[model samples]
Target: MHVLCTAGHVDHGKSTLVRALTGMEPDRYAEEHRRGMTLDLGFAWTTLPGPGAVAFVDVPGHERFVSTMLAGAGPVPAALFVVAADEGWMPQSAEHADALAAAGLRHGLLVISRADLLDPELARDDARAELAARGLGSWPAVAVSGRTGEGLDALRTAIAELVAGLPAPDPDAAVRMWVDRAFTVRGSGTVVTGTLGTGTVHRGQELELDGAGGRIAVTVRAVQELGEPVETATGVARVALNLRGLPREKVRRGDALLDPHAWPSVVEADVRLHGIGGPAQVPDSPVGLTLHAGSAAVPVRVRPLGDDVVRLRPDRPLPLRIGDRAVLRDPGAHRVVAGLTVLDPQPPALRRRGAARRRAGTLAAASGVPDAAGELSRRGAVRTGDLVRWGVPGPEVAALAARVPTAAGWLLDPTRATEAAEALDRAVAAHDAADPLDPGIPLAEARRAAGLPDVALVAVALDRAGDGAPGGPVVRDGRVVRAGDDGPPAAVLDAARQLHADLTAAPFAAPDADRLAALGLGPRELAALERAGELLRLTPDVALLPDAPDRAVEVLRGLGPEFTLSAARQALGTSRRVAVPLLELLGRRGRTLRTPEGTHRLR
Candidate 1:
């Protein structure tokens, strides 16, 4: 099915043209028919001399209803730009034209309505010239009169030709449908009417209300194209989806229904502003504007980069993919200032202008090549949409992705992959230099030291650095260690000797902190020694020698079951601070089980 929307000045006969072509009234409400003006979106279906159906979204043209017009036009890729023969061009016509251009609608036919009321030749010439001025050149124009039905056949033929030539809609990609009109059906529950961009809406598929963050499990109770029930609707077709598990109030106009996993609700984007006419000498500062994308218009604040680029921050989170074109219009002036294509929607950092530029440069370079994997090796993961914004065609972008390298399903540039591995290696070496006896740097601490972006990348880096070598153990649980460096520190070795001597002399007691301090071991130094796997500081004061055999057996033999905390403190010959940790360590080691009641025997 093919869907097209109508746009023109107020009362320019857009609705009349739709009614004339479809032989159905586009005005749904009695108030609209009586007032002779369309207040809301109207739908009509007409069968052309073709294989599929053509759906028409008759949109309101009044200046006040511009937002409504946007909602209707947002999803449709084709349009019927209507013009009244007598009036030629009006202000609303220009506004609607701008809206269509902003939304990136390029396929359309210019319909000169009320042709019978004016001199046919003059009306045709003037309409042609007027549309031409708006950059709509030589588009098949049909002069039709709703009163007389003159030229209706030609209009139908023109529409049929336009629809037939449209590129086949992609229904298997991510789902995105802009809601032009949403309401409740008596028996159908919540009905949302719009054009589906990509992906099919099956009878029982799950769809997420994107802007609202609401989930709706819909059984395609019915599908309507041009007012008649259809089995399925593809991209570029007007559709009214009867959704289950949702109410009318929940699905509003301008909301989108998309694939939950495929579509991200929040996106960070790098935008290049093309001044409407030419380059503008604009200052580098943040400015608020209205962003029009798909069927949604949102308030966004743009942080400018020099004179031409800006980082756009949408007020409300929006579902956008890489390469989606968005119009940035000055909200106060109500004029479109520029158009932007989304680069990195869901960026890691929004404030770092330098990082954004680096990413953008990488995206730009990757976009220019045929092999994205090769490019990613030099750069990083490029947002699929960003490549499109950089002027790489969709098919080419998809082709390039075949070469993209991935680790555990996450795409990684070869350079970044290499950098991550080197960073991890440097971190391990640094830790070993600082504390030779330490087992390794904690994984979190290693990542921080390496300045890696995420833990997943860090893991990949460590795994690569290890290279599955039997002798090279690059990482241990939460800690990274070099193979040869797991040796005891001098301080830990000295403490270990003292601990063993004390245990030998007083088998039932552990040494106090003063004794460990006397041997030149502090808590910070002890922690470092423990991380080095040199000495186990089982208790604050009770230091266990690394060579101690199953130390838990010694603890249980010495303390026995039902040992009191005071007795353990005295046995350790230290304060509560030292004895508590000692008891806890013994419990952990299964030497003695410490319960809430007190210590117990492991047996």
Candidate 2:
């Protein structure tokens, strides 16, 4: 079934034409039947020759109720633009045309009603010019008289051709039906009438209704397509859904039912606006306005992002996506100022200086977000949820499983993963080059250098880096460093010899950090020497040869329970500086303990 809506000036014979063709009254309310003008949405259906079942959404043409017109027209695929023959073009006609154009409506038919009142050809020519100005001139048109049924068959043929050319909606797409009407039946629960944009709705299917306070879970009790009970219904058809768990009064006209997890519920979104032919400048400051997308018309605050980009802060969060189009209107003046293309549904908070300008630059090219491969390449690494949140179709991202790296719900582009791995290897290599005597650089430092978040990301990189841990600079000592710990370099070999000779002369004595640096054997050389088992460094300035600890243990064992610092210095034949630190180390090791009289003794 194909759903189409009528758009024109007030009392332009929209309902009369539909009634004359369908053999059924289009006006449903008593006021509309008495006043002979549509004040709210009216529905009717007919069968076209080639198009089969076609539904008509007759919208209000009165200026006071244009909101009703928009609610009816937003979901329909095509439009029947009605124009009265006597009235060539009116104010409401232009306004209606603007609404259709702002909605990006591409397929339509021009019907010149009341053709008996004036020359039908002249009226058609004027209507054609007006539609051409709005970029809708290519549609099929016909002149008809509802009073005499003149050219009624020709009008049906035009509509059939229009409906035949309409593209079929994606049956598997997520359902986001905007509620145009909600009421309660005596036997049934809450029922909602709307045009299902896409996807299939089945009886007892669960859906989500995003409303004022928060989203409420709703279930479909039964389905009605074209006023008949059905078990299943597809897109491009008018449906009346009997829903459960949602209050009929709380479910307003603009509320929509959508996939809860797939789309974001955000009050603020960055949008790329399409400029309409209006003189209004893009607001530099926050301006109060109304936004129209699908069947939603709600108040919002507009903040300009760039030349044609704006950030809309709606009074209420709505279910929206990245590529959705919307119309912006100044509700006070009731004028269509511009159309918008959603750039990013979720944006960063403007916290730092010049953040807004930088954000504007990111959104300068609103359509620049590339497809699957390009998105992965741009983001470097993304989570599975991020793939959908950033607007990449979930199935397409899933298809890249073999091409990308995935672990624990994280996805990394192959090129980015390789680059990070190579960077980590370089960091390890550099650390090893600087400290030949030390273990690999600390894991923390390597992760920071590679610009990764956690150790798991590094692990994924390392597995693909091809540098095995046993032979490479990436080792585990709490610090990442070169794989091997060789002896000091030849330049520092003399320094090392002096240090060894001095330490051996007095086993408990050691060189300070300055003395080691003077000999060109610094922390790295010391670390290397210790790793090679040539020296034991308990403190920064205290280094003992490998056999020194055993010899000192014996030295302290010979001392009685009471011995002064001077006595130990004399016995060891070392400076007080060396004797003091050595005695402290022995005390810590439990070989001796300090007495109250400033003496050392076996513990």
Best candidate, TM-score: 1
TM-score list, all predictions: 0.78, 0.73
lDDT of 1: 0.67
RMSD of 2: 8.6
Local accuracy of candidate 2 as per-residue lDDT tens digits, 1-603: 999998895772878898888877878888887887898888889888898888999999876777778888887889999999888787878778877877768799999999888887887888788788777889878999988899999999998889889888989877889888889998897999899988889998988888776788889999999889999999988999999766678798888887656667877888877644443357544766778877788888987766777788988998877677677777667666776767767676778877778878876655835256655554566666755755677788788756666766677777777788778778767766775555466677777887765555666666655455555444454655444544456666667788888877767667776778788876767777776677888765567787765676677566676888887777776677777777787788887887787777876
Where model 2 places Cα greater than 4 Å from the true spot, the runs are 277-281, 368-370, 377-380, 389-391, 413-603
lDDT of 2: 0.77
Model 1 lDDT per residue over 434-549, tens place: 76656567777866765654455566565655564554436665666765553566657777667668766754354566776687777766776666565666654455556443
For model 1, state the Cα shift of residue 575 in Å. Answer: 16
Question: What are the C-alpha RMSDs, in order, of all predicted structures?
Answer: 5.5, 8.6
